[model samples]
Target chain A: MSRWKPDGRGRLEKAALELYNHKGFEATTVAEIAGRAGLTERTFYRHFADKRAVLFPSDNPLPAILADATASAPVPLPPLEVVTHALIEAAPVYEEREDLVRQRQAVIAANPELQERELAKLAALAATLTQALRERGLDTTTAALAAEIGIAAFKVAYERWINDPDEHTLAQHIRETLDTAKHLTTPAEHAAATDNVSFTGQQGTA
Target chain B: MSRWKPDGRGRLEKAALELYNHKGFEATTVAEIAGRAGLTERTFYRHFADKRAVLFPSDNPLPAILADATASAPVPLPPLEVVTHALIEAAPVYEEREDLVRQRQAVIAANPELQERELAKLAALAATLTQALRERGLDTTTAALAAEIGIAAFKVAYERWINDPDEHTLAQHIRETLDTAKHLTTPAEHAAATDNVSFTGQQGTA
Candidate 1:
């Protein structure tokens, strides 16, 4: 009943997710969501541009945080490291809204249009990471490969984290996944080449 | 014209791409594409299932080839190496159809629906690679990450190959790009510890 509640956005997101889950994203109206949150439609609009926006409210801040993390990361960090730093910085934001995240994923899974929008968002994120890597003086191929690999790692880690939340923190899981990926990708001879032999090959197309 | 020509599929693809470029994919009918190819609609159907199928002719063979390559690859090959070998197997197929490939890229670029389809295809390819890797006794995280990174490397190399044909062969370009991605992603200090010191970090949210 407090007029000046600090968690108004959180409350609205919680209500919107519940409504979206129970009645579906298409059937859930802003008025109903506002009512469920004990707020006005105007307040709901203030929090989210629209119902679809409610499912992806934090996306706005994602680019900026990623950019900042990439920029502040230690210079000469490997391409994945640069990307991993950014993911780590962004984890807390998603962690704070795990339920909403799950609901959003479910809604997206059910709707092709929403899935396309999500894909576009991911593509945009990759583009941003590529640009950031380029700014750090990585060549075009390296930048693109780094951005892509980074995104792939993020995706696998995220799916695992969501499915098995009790096992490890998202950051830990992602790190472990990256390590394993690196290990698996390294050639057996390279694994044995502890002293001096450098494994050499063409970069991307092979 | 010889009725038993080996380039029947190529001719059809060329004709279809030209028609698609001129009239747009949605507006270009199968009959028109067949006419341009100097073949009957029945002949076109023999080669392709539909108009949309022309855009993705390699859909059937790519996964199988990738699976075979992954399965038959030398045991304990590095993740990138395994992916590189699979891509190498695919190189000749892509190299032989460079013109059609560029045309396909243009057509997909013009249509959001086509782009989505392409994205879905790429995602499926990644999944196939992951599954193949998993069957090799790699853990889920390692398999997923290796597949994703390999695909990322392939994508980067393919783009470069399509953009500049003179730089290197698709297989060579892919190999170089994979190496570049791996090297760039490797931590600076532990560059020597190729196997022991695994690079760990979070993906950038940006």
Candidate 2:
């Protein structure tokens, strides 16, 4: 068989998901995944640390994008708005890879280990967002709270979007989820001032 | 050596945490943990499935307490208030076992597998709350959204209570966090109508 070309990572991930779905995560092996991808064991190792890692291929640039989006957000935006903007910016990345996203979700749903890694990654993401908010001068508690809310909204939206593929774009679903959450928290009479609070800190990182 | 007692689960957990801290989770064995707890392997097996299970001692009673609190909560209490009552019911359990709580947190923090179990437990708790809410006839999405918010509040309250031992009671911290999250969501202008909305649902399971 011809050796798998340089795009071996993508090939391996696709192959692994199929095998995992058919044979079960525990029964699948590295050798099988590599063979299916037409790549050698060395090529698989060069891309992922293990078979599980294939399910959650890391995106090294996501954090930088999220950080930059938060930093460049309009100065007077409220914390929720700041986070909303960052999420909106990040939605395209997920949207572009809908198939891979679905496969990853399925794999995680099947295996407890993969699900745990997914939660850890989300927790790490929240921590990263909290740090960014803190850098903008929010107090530790507020930063953590805001980051949690943002992550919650993102989660709600993502799940809904994934479940209903025909209804709306991920970005729109996220925006709607945020609006709904905000509405639930806001009484109809007070909706006017919801946008008035400034979430960003005036003092730059010293 | 005398035969181990059934009520020695606590002792085993304590011993396990101490050993984990000193020797790491991967290196610790059931025999070592049992020896440290003055128990035998047979007794240890009677309480827990294995070493990792010791890290996640069952807290089965928490769900029933939370469900009862939510079911009997005063009608028309704000959404946050309803959740606060549920969390208040869970406080004594955690407060009474603060040392174990801290040790459990440390053990989970130290090991990735345990961390995942912790997340799964939290997710299960959230799902339980959501189901209870659905039983009250709330729409699926609203139920989920409320449960997510409640879990977020619980997390904030938990960390604060554990980290700052002198602070208000866990119940008080939970109420305050819910209120804070509420206030952060709603500014002064919306206070009037926000209070008028009746949050009660008819007693009917979805």
Q: What lDDT does the true structure give each of the candidates?
A: 0.76, 0.73
lDDT of 1 by residue, B64-143 (tens): 98999999999868766887899899788788777788899889989988887777777778899999977876556556
What TM-scores do the predictions have?
A: 0.78, 0.84
Q: Taking the tens digit of each residue's C-alpha lDDT, what string does model 1 give over A116-174?
A: 67766776788888888777755566667778888888888888888873746788877
The DockQ values of the predictions, listed in order, are 0.28, 0.16
- Candidate 1 positional error at B41, Å: 6.7
Please list all clashing residue pairs in model 2, or write none if there are none.
Answer: A190-B190
Give the range where candidate 1 chain A is weakest over 10 consecutive residues by summed lDDT: A197-206
Q: What is the lDDT of candidate 1?
A: 0.76
Q: Model 2 off-target regions past 4 Å?
A: A1-6, A186-206, B1-7, B186-206
